[model samples]
Target: MTGRRLTSLLAYVTTAATGASLLTGCGVLPGATGGSREPVTVMTWAPDQTRATNMPGMPAMAQAYARWVNSQGGLDGHELRVITCNEQNTSAGAADCARRAVRENAVAVVGSYSQNGRAFMAPLEAAGIPYIGGYGISEDEFTSPLSYPVNGGQASLIAGHGMQLAESCRKVSLVRPDTIAGDKLPGLLNSGLRKASHRSAIDIPALEDAAEYSQQADRARTKAGREDGCVTAVLGERTQTFFDSFRRLPTGAADGDAKGEEGGKDGKEPAVRISSVLGSVGQPVIDRTGGAHSPFEGAYVTGWYPEAADKSWAPMRKVIQEHAFADNRVDPADAGVQTTWIAYTVLKEVVEGLDQDTITAAKISHALDRGARIDTGGLTPTLRWKYEDLLGAPGFPRIVNHEVTFQVVRQGRLVAQKPGFVDVGETVLSAP
Candidate 1:
């Protein structure tokens, strides 16, 4: 038969197999094994060796989390079983990962990153598995009934970045990937800028996997530096490379302003300041690019969580030290790695909240649906999900954390620009 027809047939077969597994008392349904003290299994999937964003750290962190929890006698009394998948940055790859998660009888998929939300959400919903703490790359993450997104994803980041730029930047130029998923980014950012009555930013799309972004950088730099301008790039892993290209191009001294000895006797305004979100450009990149002298030295950044040096990360660092010490894949500062840590933190709370040794996918889903409040130490404001919790944002109905942390590169580190998170709930709700 046709490829589409074959996919449907395979899906039907998997559904049938899932039904059989549940009926055979395999602990796939709600409280399948009552107080049995069995293992609580979950899946974590992320792209690896892909043309764009690569999140190998997510799965590696999941495995490390499993080792850490299991060593401590697991979440509650059940062993934490983690099944990792490499999505390969493809829709088909994502679908395969979801099917594997269903077939393996995972209760939830936690702390993962994938741009192909539609491909994965269907299978997880079919099998009643909850998707917790997703990277928020796709729109379906906010709309899917089974998705419990911990952070605001790309939506909040772009919006917050715009607002952060409004007061200081006279002209803003956005550099983004030229992909279907990257299309919505420009509009989201414009919404925030419009809220401040600022003109919409210039949208510059470039090939996602291009080895060099020199041409795109040149165009962006010219437009962004026109008058107190800024260039913001959200091209995932390629963000740093894009800035590197921009930095190589010469930016000469200004001859217009000469005030005093302290204020640049003949100093001019910054040519074009660099900016990005957490996943695209962060501390790890800064450290590698010569720290304080990095291209992102004075860049503005937005993120879902606090800095890696924050004391809140100590617990996760301790776990990493004990279990993943030698594993180079686990970078405590990587956004995906930090996301996984938070997702597992939520899972641990959810499993323990059941107050029973036995657990299943249905049980977990229902509990979250019933408004379970989970506290992630102080990492995030206590996350409690309810129907009313939905912000009723245009397409993103399930976004609960409309807050984003404003950060800037200082002394080669990504430090908080403002003291706390900026609430962009109203800003996102007003997005076109």
Candidate 2:
């Protein structure tokens, strides 16, 4: 089919998909319901069933949030309508989702995930629909004037990851995807390492969805010094595969484990420590691999939010338990789910503060751009989109919350290594 035909067909499918929600008390019914405020419609898209990183949970969480909020008479009396799409992890797919959002007259694209930032952002920009609370994997999420990011994106996480490993690892090897987004990882990471006067890491680029990484693993292991060295992989879903290959190596066993702090079993060559960012590795991955016996046991993790077990997540946990009890996709521990929850939180704040009879894309963006402050119930520092609040970092000027948390896997559970958030705004600014 031609591009226009494909877009038209996608719009039809997207609209049709939401029809089932009406029976579940979560569908959009144009105009006011029972004299309540006008309903606010939004879209949430993420890659599902993809070869690369798939975040079905992000859209799932958005739907769950809509159900929960609508159950409570909606957000400040305005019924919340959520339209979900599967971006399919392709540029065309991402663009399709954005075009559907426009066709559906969505006020904003909230709590969505997509690596094809350029593909999606253009359509949203042309429609004047604000891109809110995107999973910050692509640089476009940080640069688009219409995009309002809830987290500091990969730039903060990688930079913070570098800082997290600086004092511990003697040498670092970064195994990242060889893509436009992946190209920036080294500079961001190096900036953080340089703060501690540590040397630059060995940059090893690999396919994002490679079936195995024995070669890259071997190279990373060799580059990491024999003793007190670390290898950090940020290859999304393939991170597990990389580590699986990594451990099969003669020295991969007990990697990042304290048993090898001094040296390997032979007490001569130490196993390299392993690490990754939140999306690449999380509680779900650990639980699946074998909790308490998982390969991630002693691995370092950097994230944009507090640990999943933190008390701050109680509200989100409650929503998931009550409204999303049967939805296994909405894992409270998953960062995508957490981001969606936070994104909806921002939306709620924006909607309630408006107190308007009807909400629109222009109105939502105007409220945010005019210095609307959002309190995520302590999930993140107060988020505002004012020009003065930005980081002014090269290629990422929209980063306002440049804070990251340091986490470590202890007994197969990710826990905070250091209390409180670490400010990486300066580190992002100093990147090459």
Best by lDDT: 2
TM-score of each: 0.88, 0.90
lDDT tens digits, residues 54-133, model 2? 99999999998998898787877788889999999999999999999999999999999999999999999999999999
Q: Which digits, one per residue and each the tens of the lDDT, describe model 1 over residues 1-432?
A: 999999999999999998777754543233334335877889999999888889999999999998888766678867788999999989999999999999999999999999899999999999989999999998889999899989888999899888888867888889998987789889889988887899999999998777888888777877775567788999999887787777665544242121111112143335566788999987888888888766677778889888888999999999999999798889999898998998899899888899776789999989988998888877777786789887778778898888888898887889998887789888888888
* TM-score of model 1 vs. true structure: 0.88
RMSD of 1: 11.6
* RMSD, one per candidate, in order: 11.6, 9.9
Q: What lDDT does the true structure give each of the candidates?
A: 0.84, 0.90
Candidate 1 collision pairs: none
Estimate the overall C-alpha local distance difference test score of candidate 2. Answer: 0.90
